[model samples]
Every structure is written in structure tokens, then in C-alpha cells.
Target: MVPTMVLVADDSQDTDRKEALRDLADAVAERGEAPVVRAFGSGSEVRRAVHSVEGPMVVVPAFVAGGDFASAQLFAGLDLEGRFDACPTAPLGAVPSMVADLAGRLSASGWTDGDGVVLAADGSTGQDERQAVTDVARMLSRRLGSPVQVGYLNSWAPSVGDAVERLQRNGRERVAVAAWRLVEDRDYDRLHEMGAASVTAPLWPSEIVVDSLLAQHRAAKARLAA
Candidate 1:
């Protein structure tokens, strides 16, 4: 069966991360799937571009410093709530061991050696986030007997596009992006376009995750009462 095609739209015009996005696109193409990954510096451009395509497509916004407005506009333009199912979103702290365990699970579930990308947030410079990613990379490397690359959501840490570039530089054939914030359909679409698979921690915790869950629970109770 032909895999679904996806499009990635982000707002980073002149960054070096374009290489990573290209690597991701190549990975998807190699999967015998048709994924079209494209990046734009503005949500308006992406929105216009997507309308020209038919069938299902995913869009991912690059993590801008403090602008979710574009993301929100993208979501509205796409009517995401009506189009795709919402996956639970979670924020995770530095948990190297847990990440390693999750990597193992991904492997068991059919991720091939060096065919994975872990997306993490830019650890505050003095924080353990960076260390956690490094440790997990080491663990995954040992498990796969090959080096595993890490990507960051924001530009502060190594960007996801940058990590993808590094993997390409190392000649990795296929890659999957395991990230926390890629839960939205748009994000998933971005990964698909880049030719990278997307996965996240199941029990990872984050403010958004917690709030969404709680809201759901309350809604369920209200429905029951009604």
C-alpha cells in the first residue's frame, strides 16, 4: 500500500537546518512512501501551498521563540480538530533511562538500526536536559550498535532540522523523530513530509498534557451527569 503523503511548513527562512529537513524528506521517499516535505517562513505561505494538494497532508510549524499564533492559524486553516484524531501530548524532563527504555520499545516495534531521531527541548543551558539526551543517545547507540542522533525543538538546542542533517552526513538511510511536542497533526505532517516517522513518550508529563487530560476527564463526567 502507498503510504500517505505529508507536507511540513515551518517559519525558519535562513537557517542551516534545511539540510535536516531534506534528509528527513529523503528518508520518507526511501520508505516507498510518498511524503512531500516543504518548509515556509510563514504560515500564510504554507496554508496557500497546502490547498494546492489533494488528499491528507500534515503540517508542522518550526518552534519559533514565542509565537504560537502562526501555529494556531495553521490549525484553524487546516480544521485539524475535524480532520485528525488528537494524541495525548506530554512534556518530559530529562530521563535518560526512560528514553533508552522507550528506544528499546521502538526497536522492538520495528524501528531499524539508525532509523530513529529523538526530538528534545533545548535544555536550559545549565539544566540536565542536554545531559539526558546525550545519555539516551549513548544508550541507543550501544543498543543499535550504531550512533543515534538527537534533535531539539527550539533553535536554542540543536534544531531538529540540524540533527536530521547530521544523520544524513553520517549516511543514515531512514529516521524516526521521537519528540514531545510533535503531538499535533501539523507536527506529524511535518515529520511525514520530511520522511521521518514520529513517536513520543506514552506516560510523559507536561503542562499541556496534564491540562488536556484533566479537561477531558471533566468533560466525561459532565457528559455522564447529563
Candidate 2:
């Protein structure tokens, strides 16, 4: 079977963005589906491609920092509902579902109870970003059947390392960290340096989730495949 193709749109040409998209593409491909990953350097480019793509395509926005509003507007401007199934960059409401999905992935990856923590940061300084983190943490905790704390790297609160230390000091056996922000090489290196494991949520690209966008993309993909 031919795998689904997902288009990744971002304004920056940075390495972090590229890696995140690749990770997502790999995840989709691992589902036994084909994926054609396309990167856009601007919203205009993304908008244009949205019209040109022939099949179902997941539009992943590269706006990780503070451009969510603009990204949201661009997605909205495309009137995706009229033409395609759009899955926006992030979908926090799907955190519970994502947590369930993560549980399986973590278990497969050798994660055990009380051994991992979900780490997320609101790098965009947007109110929704913080809420998204909290939502994912809550869902993960529920799904894991234990308390899973969330920490922000950019906040005044304890850093990722500090969070790990606290968990270790409290006698947690294995500790893993998950972030919603762009998983840059430095970020991954830092997680390794801190002795914490990390995983990124598939639904919340860049730690943000816009449900309408996700629905659109999913619908478009289904329509094309059908």
C-alpha cells in the first residue's frame, strides 16, 4: 500500500525544524504508510502547495516559537474545510488520545511506571502553549496510572535537569522526558546530558495542537485515499 504524504510547512530553515519534521515523517512511515515530507519556507509557499497537492496531506506548521496566531490565520485563510482535511500543527485536546498512543510507544521503548516524565515548554509565550503542556501531562498521568509531572525549560520553574534530579532524589526508578517544542539537536543533547529520556507528541507539533487543523488533514487524507 502507498503511504500517506504529509507536507511540513515552516517559515524557518533551521535544523531543529527539519529534524522535527523528519521525526514526524518517520513516525508516519512506521505506521506502514508512505509519507512524502515537504518543507515550506514561508506561509505563502505552504498555502500554494496546499492547493497543488493531489492527495491527503498533513500540513505541519514550523511555527514553534510565537507565530501560532499567524500560522492559525494562514491555515484559516486557506479555507481548508472547503478543499482539504487539515490537521493543524498542534492538537492539545487530543492529548488523552496521544497519551494513550505514547503509552504504547513508551512501553515498546522499554519505559516503565515512575521512570519517565513528560517535559514541555511554552516557548511561544502563548497562553495556549502552557495549557497544552498541562493537558498532555494530565492525560499522560491518567494513562500511565501514576502522577506524571511536567516541567518547562524556559520558565522560572525548575529546568529539565532539575526536574530529573527531583524525581531521582524522590526515588523514581527510571526517568524519561517528553517535550512539545522543536526537538532540536541541542535539546536532545541536553536531555541526554541531563540523563533524562525524551519523546515528542505526534499530535502536538511544536507542543501545540489545533484540532480543526488535524481534522482537516485527516479528512483530506481519507478523502484522497477513498
Candidate 3:
């Protein structure tokens, strides 16, 4: 077994962006996942600078469907670089606690019975990823006690706008959008423009992600040690 590595950030991505993830990764290496790291400030921003890295070793994926592609690309890059022992944390979607996190955001957004739901995802090319999104939607639906519709921001049919509009056309007003990505991004801004009554925030800056990252990292690392 290889040594397990926690993914707080995808160093494989742009040089910037994930100072917190990388910092948490480093903290996980030395201390633990959540020990008042020097990096985390206000639980919202990173106080320190993120040093540059050569390549991606582990990706703390934002969401499963989109993380799949980024992780694959990073894995391939590792192969090309001759670093084969790299490991990454499972996608946030794989973390059961995330379901609660999703539900929390929905509730905060005032989602209730008779209001339409659109589980908006970043979209992916893999069928498995699509299934993963659907599975999450199903979970959310059960939690909400109502039907949930899936809408892709890119890649597949039934766009977010279309889904929202479809619900509106059906006379179900007050549509809420649950963005399943890791962090809030520009892509989600348009949801409000589309007249979503509420758009749930991403998964980061929450205890669920922090706790999930720690658990998944320990499990993977334990496997390697075994």
C-alpha cells in the first residue's frame, strides 16, 4: 500500500485558487485536518500565501461529477511525470455528510413543499458521474419529501434555465437551485439571473467538507500504511 495523502486542494489546477485546500493538506500531513491551522482565517479566507507546486498529487474534489475529470487529468499528468504513488480524497459527493450539507443550504434558501427543485450540477461527460448526480438528487428529494429535477450547466441536455423554466411553466413557482459544486463560482451567478428563488451555496467553507476531507484522507492513508 502507498502512503495516503489528503486532498485539501487540487494543486494540479491553476497556481492560485486553493490556498486553503493546500494548507489543509499540509496541516493534515503534520498535525491533523482541523487543528486551528495557520492557514485558515475566519473560516472564510486564507491568511497566508500558497506556494507554487510542480504538479497535482491529490485532488480534494469539489464535487464527484466534475472532480472525476480533473482527477483523471491529474492522474494522467502524474503518469507522464513518473509519479505513480499519488492518492486523492474521494469526491465530496461520496461523503454521506454532504447530503446534510446540501439539505442545510436548501432549508436556508427557504425550500418547502410545492416549491420546485432543480439540482444543478456542473455537468460531466461520464455516465457514472451523471448517475452520481442523479443519486444525489434522489437523496435530496427524499430529504425534501418532493420530486427533484436534474439540470446540467454544461455537457448534457435539460439546461439549468430550461429546468427552471419548465417548473415555472408547470405553475410551480419559487424554484430553488442547489449548486453541487465545491465552491461558489461565476458559473452559478446566472442561476439568479434565470430567476431562481434561491440558489444554495457550494460545499466549501462548511464543517462537512472539512470533516469529510479529514475522514477520507485518514482512510486512504491507512490503506497505504496497511
Candidate 4:
């Protein structure tokens, strides 16, 4: 087996963010498969770490969806000028398992068909990124047998507050906001101000998430071997 390094590139300077990624790294190691390193801070920092590795590597963004920072932009800043051994899978949110996690979170919170849901994600400037969040919302909609709206914490239209108001206008008084983030940030805090009856936690520290990360790593390794 090739010595693979699991890289987590995150932009947040918060201590909790670093700790959470470290916890995730611990979880990855617990799988008894590959060695893990928890590098946090910036894309460049992660890039420098990746550049030191001499074998197959999988850089999995610790993000739920592909926001501008988590997608190509993050990797673009890396010093991988000629490195082809490192591979990146899609953002964790795009995987189908996350939809199940979101559904389960909402259902566990007493959400019903009569209730409304707003898929809350951090703001991103790219329309493609916004669509990714929307796609996750639609998947949740299908799972719960109801409609789910998309909302952002920073960039784009249809803020969580706006979604909540719209749902209330549509006669759905009970509204919940499903967190489409990996860790809590200022954006996660804004969920309460949106007037949601309930807000779910970010997708992390779950068996489903660990499974998703492992799956992405395997796929990327396969791609590299091919």
C-alpha cells in the first residue's frame, strides 16, 4: 500500500476549527487504515505540508460543500506546481451520505412533513457553489417529503432569515434550518437570528462523515494508481 497523507485545508483561524480537524484526523487514524495529519490555518500551510510527502496523497477539504474557498480556489493556492500525486475528491456535502445525515438530524429534532426546512450554508461568491448547496437542500426535500429552501450566511441571496419568512408566509410556521457546515462559525450563529424553530448541528463527529472521508480517500487513491 502507498503511504497516503490525508490533508485538511481550512481557512478559519479559530482554535476550535483546528481542534475539530485534529479530532477528524484522530478518527481517520482510528479506522486502522492510513496515517493522518491534522494541519489547519491556511491553504498555503496545507500545501507546504503536502509538498513534503513523497507518495500518494488525498486532500479532503473539511467542508460540507464546495464553496469558493473549499473548492478549486483553496487548491490553487497550494505550491503544487508540478505535483500530480495528490488528488482531491468532491466536497463532503456533495456525497449522498450527507443527505442521509441531514435528514436524520432533522427527523431526530421532531421535524415532520408539515414542517419546513432551510438548508443553511456559508456564503460563497460563485453561483456554482450556491447551486451545490441548493442541490443538498433538494435532496433533503426529497427525503423528508417536503420542500427545502436554500439560505446563505454571507454571500448570495435568500438568507436564512428570508427563507424563514417565506416559509411562514406560505403557512408553514414550524421551520428548521439544517446546518450544511462542517464546524460552527459566525455563519452558524446566524441561524438563530433567522427565526428558525430549530437549527441542526454541523455535519461532523458522525460515523457517516468518517465513512464519507474514507470513501473519498479510497476513490482518490484508486484514481492515482490508475
Q: Pick the candidate with the highest TM-score.
A: 4
Candidate 1 on 74-119: residue-level lDDT in tens? 4344544543322211123333444455565566545776475554
For model 1, what is the C-alpha lDDT against the true structure?
A: 0.44
115-165: candidate 3 lDDT, tens digit per residue: 999988866656667778888888988888988888877657788889999
TM of each candidate vs. truth: 0.39, 0.56, 0.73, 0.89
Q: Roughly what TM-score does model 1 have, to 2 decimal places?
A: 0.39
- Residue ranges of candidate 3 with Cα displaced over 4 Å: 1-59, 67-84
Count of backbone collisions in candidate 4: 1
Best by lDDT: 4
Supply the global lDDT for candidate 2: 0.53
lDDT, model 3, position 136: 89
Tell me the tens digit of each residue's lDDT in model 4 across 1-226. 6547555656455666667667777887899777776555676677666666777677776676643244235654555556677776666656678788889998887777899888877765555666688788778888888888887766667777898899999999899888888765555666878888889877877888888888888888889889
Of 2 and 3, which scores higher on lDDT?
3
Alpha-carbon local distance difference test for all models:
0.44, 0.53, 0.60, 0.73
Reference-based lDDT, residue 52, model 1: 53
Model 3: lDDT to the true structure: 0.60
Q: Which residue runs of candidate 2 sit more than 4 Å off their true CA positions?
A: 1-13, 19-39, 42-93, 181-185, 197-214, 218-226
User: Which consecutive 10 residues in model 3 have the weakest lDDT in total?
Assistant: 43-52
